[model samples]
Target: LAPQPKAPPSPPAPQALELPPNASPVLSSGPSPPPAPKASQPPPSGPSPPTAPKAAPPPPPPSKSGGPLPPPPALPGSSKTRPPPLMKSGNKTDTDEDSSEAKTKLKPFFWDKVATNANKSMVWDHLKAGSFQLSEDAIETLFGCNADKKSGDAKKDIASKEAAQVVRILDPKKAQNLAISLKALSVSAEEVSCAVKEGNELPSDLIQTLIRWVPSTDEELRLRLYTGELSQLGPAEQFLKAIFDIPYIYERLDALLFMAGLPEETSNVKQSFATLEMACEELKNSRLFLKLLEAVLKTGNRMNVGTFRGGAQAFKLDTLLKLSDVKGTDGKITLLHFVVQEMIHSEGVRSARAAKEQTGSVSSVDNNDLIEEEYKQLGLQAVSSLGDELQNVRNAAILDADQLAMSVASVVHRLGKTKEFLNTSMKSLDEDSGFHRKLVHFVEQSQTDVTFLLEEEKKIRSLVKSTVDYFHGRTGKDEGLRLFVVVRDFLAMLDKVCNEVKEASKVTPKKTKTEFPHTQVFSRSPA
Candidate 1:
């Protein structure tokens, strides 16, 4: 069988062009290569002038021994047309009349392009566009800052540069510190990710610092921070632990989500399901849910549907659904709140209709009385909403000890971080906030009262203790500590409310210095 079939010949391999060490491009003698067509130049025409071969230009002056090519001199008839005249420039060299120089000059070096004495607003605009281009030394000099701002370099280094440029040139460590200390953002504040090249933690203390800076105190920020910290927290569990203790609901929400190993919202259906559910919870919170009511009311300025039941969680659409049902339980509160205003409005209309009828001015305080009633109802419902939220979370997930410790640490961390805790508006100086602050001071000063229930070897009575226990049971120390932060927040809110109650009886002694705007609508009728 082997002898019967002759061996098949192999096909030849394709040859490749390999240049030798001393090889140069081979030129064809048949005809000189058509001179490279000039960009935007007309082609040559007419009979050939001569058949003699033209000599190639000498190999470009051997590249000046190690420098770039000396540009070729203009050949007699190389281009039919003369080049355009160049402008005289103070910073440019004048070339020969026949030189084939490009009209535009070489760009100045990077240094020449800097804004040494640029206006702050001009630089600010550039920075806003992410175009910072200055060196650190240049930046410092321009801003009139030195390394020590009691005269520090930071104050001096405020030069114009692209955001990316400054971030790129600085020592990552120093840059990160400056970024935090300045309260300015090159991009979004959170995008200033400190380079963690060699260590486990960010040397600038970004996590701990942001934990302190996150603008939250009410259910709002506490709630948002809980969610914000979830995605960006990295493998540095200890740093995360430090921030995890922040006393905010949102921060705790972040802790719980991560502790339960809830994957972030992604294209994956499973992860999306979890994120959407929490978002849904937020939408139902009284503040957010109330917007829907406000939206419906605004169409008619304010509306009145008497003797019906309603709630913070109930949508107006739901109320409409219940309109035909047996006695609406809370619709009556909505009615009573809006009824006076609406009745006055109706009276105004009727008075107008009769032309001769007279109507008295509707006092603004009529709306205000209803507003105070709404405030009490709203506060109660808000506090109740939190209680329900905690219940829902506890029912939904169990956290590990590491996660719990992380959460508690974030809270305890922020408590010591700031010299003062003031809401970020001009109204922070109002009477209502003064009493509020005093109350907080009272609670914070009395650690015993704060921890009175911790003395219990028996039932863990306080919200903080219970929250910690819940985390400790499964998650471990870190996350449990974080949960404790949430517990403290809940307790703090409880204290604030209790203090406000005490304040309501006393005249203005218990008022907060901060003044939030008051509503003019009632949330519920008094029992």
Candidate 2:
């Protein structure tokens, strides 16, 4: 701490007076002075006679207590004269001194005492407990004047108030202690430099933690201008000052952290792109999925026969999710259920034909039992597996295009910053300097990797846009990500329908055959 200026001396106490034996009793000290003597009446009508001068009074002796005597009381009589007021020794008046004494007598605030004794952890513990509240005056005295100016609200919670005070005051030791308690690394700047030069990676967590505790501009300036012994400063200040010797320290740390994470980030982005590609392929090429959509279109056209919606050629993918909302006359089976049933019968018939062709068998079955049993088994197997066939679409549905783009952008931005540091801040370094050489190589390699990533990102984004357009017909600006979501939801409804169909097939008697009256509206063609 800097040395504080000394306070001025207090004025001496007033002492008791020792009056002479012949002195009048009224001359004793009192709050008010006595009246002064009036002039003698002028001698009547003639030249005044010269009067002899009276002898001067003798000096009064000092009191036995060996202190100066108080001023004598005024003589009786003419006009009263008041004594001069006591002079103040400094800017502080007597009342100010009394207040200072009172403050000194009061117990110190808990945090203030903790700071003085260097029990920083205890201070934090007490603060975290939040068992005590501080007055505005206590905050000013403990931290500094106007510490609350940042918040402007006096009703802020204790933790925030104390944190704001600590930040504003710039107590290096306290900051360092808090950092250490919070698991900051104890390694010195030279250790870090040596580690980097030796081609060894620093702990990723260590770099992350230290990056947060980097000194602010004002703190850095204060450290640079400090004229005191380095030993006198706290470890935080010393470490910060030492790191100042390493050019582009912050940039280097940031680059190292970025490089450490780049591989995983790139892998994630690649996986997302792959999922998107698979989702698009599944939507465009899955035969059974296309057939299911054809059935939906035929059904919808039949329902809207007399309206303007009749004979519609296509519909948005989002309508697939709404099939469950249209219930049958029985109020149990949904339109999705109807579609699943039709697809099942179609798949079962096709499978039966394929099986018949492969086996070259022709078995005659007059009874409906054999026919119903045979087709039901094949249809349920085909419809139940649709969810598994479009697994990539399910995965892709959870992804956000903008978030992925931002992640790639973040990597590129960090690489750009690293490159800028290498070019600008390390210009003075010789070509042979290990620090400069290593960082330059890192930046160059990173830029190359990021360039590849940017190209991949652009390619994937374009693919996603084209895929959205293929399905949705020119999606809104924000609709690229929504395509997979809509499909994913439709797939969920399809799964529910498949489950219901399988359950229904099990319960229905072999004698009873399931019929689709709605299928009569469309031609019995492949779609």
Candidate 3:
């Protein structure tokens, strides 16, 4: 068999650190990436004598891509001084290639020693595992006032205790420094809780700072922790628990949920108001319905001409409901039936003539067709139609405007109450301070958002009351539900009657050319 080349010598074994069992590196044994540029510089390349490969450390498991992991990175401040280049036979040309090879051979040993030292320093454990404990000096700096005092239960006692204990423990400047260090070390929430418990009361500044620094203490976690009444807590945890205890916190939460629905509520009101305005405008201004009403009034007058009810000056809108109650002598059809028949016949006469005059041909006019053409001209077709527009109005009208207004007003009131409580109880949150400034900005913005549609709402409010009064109804603090029902039923009945008239007209026969000779005369005379 052909001779096989011996396997290349292994890379050097890395030096290991001596650590307590519990304090060993928490970082993964797999190789890490290169250290930052500022920590280490790459070595210069040159040639030197060839050297055997240094021994390699235990190989990392094959990566997902089927290669071994790279070596762990050198730590910051762990780089070694580069030695002078090696020479071979005192010739520059011969030494150039060999120098590069020798440099590669020696590099692993130096890096192994540097990495071992870095692991011994335990900085990696602190940064990677977030296991850094508060030093004695840091603890002393935070709570080092050498005195103890007792607090009383009465008003004076509470004041004295808060003044002595809470104030001294929460020095703003020291707390800020501590927060900076904790952030740098990537301290865990448990560590933060422990640190806070060591100090009795949390300063408003600290609370504000920590909220930004530690976003992990989310609303859900805060609620879960605060809701548990039997759990033992540190002073910091207790302070956090107390902050949540503020009644306004619950109020604020409820307000947020309510605010979520405000957009849809506001949209419904605006759209409903627009629809009602359109429908009412058509009812007030359309001439077709007016003419129809006049015909009905004439019928009523003729019916009661010899009676005491004859020649009425004006009739209430409620009179429309009584038309069905007034039956003919046959008792099979009511006054409403006669009225609808008259309206449909009128539509046929007027529309057939107009069609002959416009088209100059009686053959083009179908007297049996519904008065849809006249309806279009009088704008009554759109008024009688009910779809999303009617629904929009109903949705708006059914809303408890007073309740919505009260809910919004309540939130505004609570904001003011919270501001007062904060000012009176925590006097430490100075008006000019960052926390106070941010808080004021928030309140102002909230008030603006809550009251954005107030003016439009006021106009709609008055309009709604007027609508009720117009219908001879009243809705005292009921958000117009009764008023809306009346309007809804009235419009629905009108639509049904209009539909009936149209359907009845469809079965009526067409006016033939022989029946109307006026169209032939007009067509011949026209230029």
Per-candidate Cα lDDT values, in order, are: 0.35, 0.69, 0.49
Evaluated against the true structure, the overall lDDT of model 2 is 0.69
True lDDT of residue 137, candidate 2: 74
Give the clash count for model 1: 83
Ranking 1 against 3 by TM-score, winner = 3
Supply the global lDDT for candidate 1: 0.35
Tens-place lDDT digits, model 3, residues 1-527? 99755555444433542343455344555555443333122332333323432322333344666454454544445676555455667665746778755532221223343344643756554575555675655554444433112212366786676555542222345445544644555544554344332322233344444544332335326544554442344333444344443333332332333334445555655555565555544444545555556656777777788999988655545576677687878886667766654554454455446657787665644445534445233333433443234554445445565675675566556656656655664355233433334445555665665565466556666776675555454534433545555445545665666676566546865443343222111111101
Q: Write the per-residue lDDT of candidate 1 for residues 1-527, one digit (tens) a residue.
A: 56544334444322433344576775643433334223232332433332322333433323325543344445546675555555557645657743534322232346645555544555434455555464645544545323334344444454333232321322345335544544442223222222211112232343344444443235233333444433333222213333334333233232222222212211132222233334334334534234324533442343333324222322323232222232225553333223223222323333233332234444332333333334343344443344344443332233333433343344334433321332322134443433234334433643332132223312322333344343234333333224423433433443344445445535744222134232445342211
Q: Backbone clashes per model, in order?
A: 83, 2, 15
List candidate 2 segments past 4 Å from native: 1-178, 181-190, 196-199, 225-235, 362-370, 431-433, 475-478, 514-518, 523-527
For model 2, how many clashes? 2
Find the 10 residues in a row with the least total lDDT in model 3.
Answer: 518-527
lDDT of 2 by residue, 300-366 (tens): 9888899999988989888898888999899988888877777777777767666766887677323
TM-score of each: 0.17, 0.62, 0.39
Clashing pairs for model 2 are 35-77, 36-78
Worst 10 residues of 2 by lDDT: 30-39
